[model samples]
Target: MTMAENGTDTAAPQEGEQQQIQMQILAQYIRDMSFENIVAQKGLHGGEVTPEIQVQIGLDARKRPVENQYEVILKFNIESKNKDSEDKMFLMEIEYGGIFHVAGVPEDQLHPFLLIECPRHLFPYVRRIVADATHDGGFPQLNLEPVDFVQLYRQQAAAQQQAAAQSAQA
Candidate 1:
């Protein structure tokens, strides 16, 4: 059978091989969420304020108590500011989680799989929530661009590696 670069077998399994990789989203929920309309809070009425938005993402994954179950949490921190004055316009924070039942993936690749694949499944929901929150906060709806999970994973991994190397040298 062919093996994929991510360490999963591509072709069908031969006799006596393990079952195919399986992943299912058993449950998904917004664990915590908050939206702040800083413009209103600060009473900042402006003249043709241009917005600059920053979005930050974090991911965490842990194995659940039950076998083959895992919990993945995707965290978002979004802030918008006036491009000229740099005054904060709005802030949105959310923690979205999913309970996944996964099987047949090798342990070596499970971490990347969870952090990358699971977030893709939950990003649409997170995007919608952010848009709704901004709209309800008296601002125009903010539609987030699609995330590049693979690139994010690679960048995070590189950062961690750099930190580890620096610490080791110290």
Candidate 2:
């Protein structure tokens, strides 16, 4: 096996090989964003505040009118609350989207490719936005842990399969 120019492993070509897969990000942008500081709104002050944060993620993808183009969106919902009082500290919701031009990916693999790889490319920007939102909201900067896209994709696939089976039985 040898590494292709794109840094992916490829077997030495002895026969006519399929075209190499190609992908390019055409654009990335924040579709929507909101941040609210509940503590500030409530006029709370003066205490050692320990925060517990929850992060929820959702993904969506759709084919664009343009050929070989798809739009993928990653949605994030984050909430922080005081550990002791359980009062809400802040809330943030952001939807980040990317337009990708992808070609040569087999039809069966395209779904996973958009859901996993595209989001991975967009995550760092999302992280930075989250950190800034929290810090600028007058709280300690919140750095999100890295997400495991592969595991997430597998779980979603399993759930879909289970739902289909249940529906068929019903």
Candidate 3:
């Protein structure tokens, strides 16, 4: 019987084998980042402005494969606005990507490594950049806490499944 038919290849390397996994930052740049310090100037001048700030965070990810290497990007956007005046005070977007050279890993383990471990490794740098940019833009530092991507992925998947089930029932 061929390896394909058995769902397990005998020639596949065992877990913890001398597999090579390399994580490299091929390119890191701000795909787009914007910051508006409308309130900063006004506040400095003692102008009448509300102190309330509204922050919105967005997350996105994409995967690219080149030969045997994989490039995954985790994009984030943060927008802060003054709720009362409906004026945007701050906006920042970052696209962080890492290229991984992974081999001798079983197919089943690849998904977790890419979606969870790889992103976890890259999050600190991304968070730092965002915080620094916001601070340098004359606004308060925007230090975002680390996220549990595994739990997030599971929650999202569960929500999707629930929605699909409800739609089917409907």
Candidate 4:
């Protein structure tokens, strides 16, 4: 077997062939996780409780080629304010993430696996943690509904494409 000039075996990966991919959860961690109940007590005692809740969510993904793994992080911040008092009644923040190892997958499949599959796999555990933390913080259990990551991914992709198209047209 002769090595290519780049020192990699040229014959290893064949074109148009379906590679046997192996995916595993190498490690899952809340790398920089934080849950803050900014107005837990206030919400319970404050008069004119506001039913309005503001929620902000952010997502990020990073790949570690050396470990052949990817890390996907989801961050959320929620705030509830009293409409009358104009003061915050409840605040909750969660930063959760997961690590996945994917190998031998086709290039076309990698994005979906990371953006959709990995997050779907990790959501349950993250939801559990968030619920427990909120309950322990003197709030009702935050029973977050399951999220459809695939739909979310597709929506995001479509929005990006639309934006790009608009920009090009402009």
Give me the overall lDDT of model 1: 0.93
* C-alpha lDDT of residue 38 in model 3: 62
lDDT of 1 by residue, 16-51 (tens): 887779999999999999998888888878789999
Residue-pair clashes per prediction, in order, are: 0, 0, 0, 0
Looking at model 3, residue 62 earns an lDDT score of: 47
lDDT of each: 0.93, 0.93, 0.67, 0.74
Q: For every model shown, what is its TM-score relative to the native structure?
A: 0.89, 0.87, 0.64, 0.72
Supply the global lDDT for candidate 4: 0.74
Ranking by lDDT: 1, 2, 4, 3
| Tens digits of lDDT, candidate 3, 19-111 | 666556565555555556665656644345454443333334445656557666677767776556666676666677767665555677776
lDDT of 2 at 118: 91
The sequence of per-residue lDDT tens digits that candidate 4 reaches over residues 1-170 is 56989898667556767777887877777755555655754344644454566666666778876667888887767776667766765677777787788887777778877888778778888778877877887666776777778787888789889999999999
* Position 149, candidate 4: lDDT: 82
TM-score of 2: 0.87
Error of 2 at 56 (Å): 0.6
Residue 103 of model 2, lDDT score? 95
The worst-scoring run of ten residues by lDDT in candidate 1 lies at 9-18
Look at candidate 4 and give me any clashing residue pairs: none
